[model samples]
Target: MKRIAIDMDEVMADFTKKHLALFNADYNEAITLEDLQGKKLRDLRPHLVDEIREYLKDPTYFRDLDVMKDAQEVIKELSESFEIYIATAAMHFPSSFTAKYEWLQEHFPFLDDQHFVFCGDKSVIKADYLIDDNVYQLERFTGEGILFTAPHNIHEDRFIRVNSWANVRDYFLK
Candidate 1:
């Protein structure tokens, strides 16, 4: 059976939504999703880059992130045809390891714990496919990389893009 390595942040989990909500509340700014199209939070507000990084350092940040729309349903369906694995770059923020794992357990209980890959680099991943929002990570991957659309990668057209879970299903299931 073919294996599919999936990204955790911004792909299966709504990292941007939670991050923006916290940043907006703390900074007293109202930045909408439309404002973030084709750019990252840091790129949009360079002065607040440090503040944004602080949010990521908070251990609770990843604990309650909303699951991406239809991600659970679509991944469950995909699991029937592919070996599913959740690959996350947890080394960037060590505090997020436990929270991310717990978040995955809560939102994606159907996935086995052993399939989780927490590392600093994605190039080490060996799978038939990798679905991620980061273009840099995809560039090094040996298999086909499906870009899971995110604000930061909105303009990137180097890889096959899936705008939503529905698009993912359409691409793989039908």
Candidate 2:
């Protein structure tokens, strides 16, 4: 069976939504997804960039993120045919290790703990395919890279793109 490495944040988890909610609530700003099209949060609101970094460092930040729509269902279905792995870059934030692991356990209990990879670089992941929101990770991957569309990567066109979990199902399961 072919292995598929799936990204956690912005792909399997609703990182953008939670990040925006926290930032908007604290800064009294109304930054919508439309405002972030083709741009990162830090790029869109450079003034509040520091606060954004601080948010990722918080222990509850990754732990409290909601699962991406249809992600659990589609990924569960895909697991029947493809080898599924959750590949997350957790080293970026030392505090996120436990939070991310716990979040995965809570939201994706069907996945085996051994399949979870918490690392700094995604290029080291050995899989036949990689579904990630960041093009940088995909760029370095040795296998097929499918861009899981996020507000920041809406305009990126270098790799195949899947706008939703349903799209992901169609791409692989169909």
Candidate 2 worst ten-residue window by lDDT? 44-53
Q: Which residue pairs collide in model 2, if any? A: none
For candidate 1, the clash count comes to 0
Q: Listing every candidate in turn, what is its Cα RMSD in Å to the true structure after a full C-alpha superposition?
A: 0.8, 0.8
- Indicate the worst ten consecutive residues by lDDT in candidate 1: 149-158
- CA lDDT for candidate 2: 0.92
lDDT of 1 by residue, 116-155 (tens): 9998788999999999999989998899999999987888
What lDDT tens digits, residue by residue, belong to model 2 across residues 1-174? Answer: 999999999999899998899889998999999999999989978887888899999888899888899999999999999999989988889889999999999999999999999987888999999999999899999999999989888878899999999999999988
Query: For candidate 1, what is the TM-score?
Result: 0.98
**How close to the true structure is residue 39 of candidate 2, measured as C-alpha lDDT?**
96
Model 2 stretches with alpha carbons more than 4 Å out: none
Give the alpha-carbon lDDT of every model: 0.93, 0.92
After superposition of all CA atoms, the RMSD between model 1 and the true structure is: 0.8
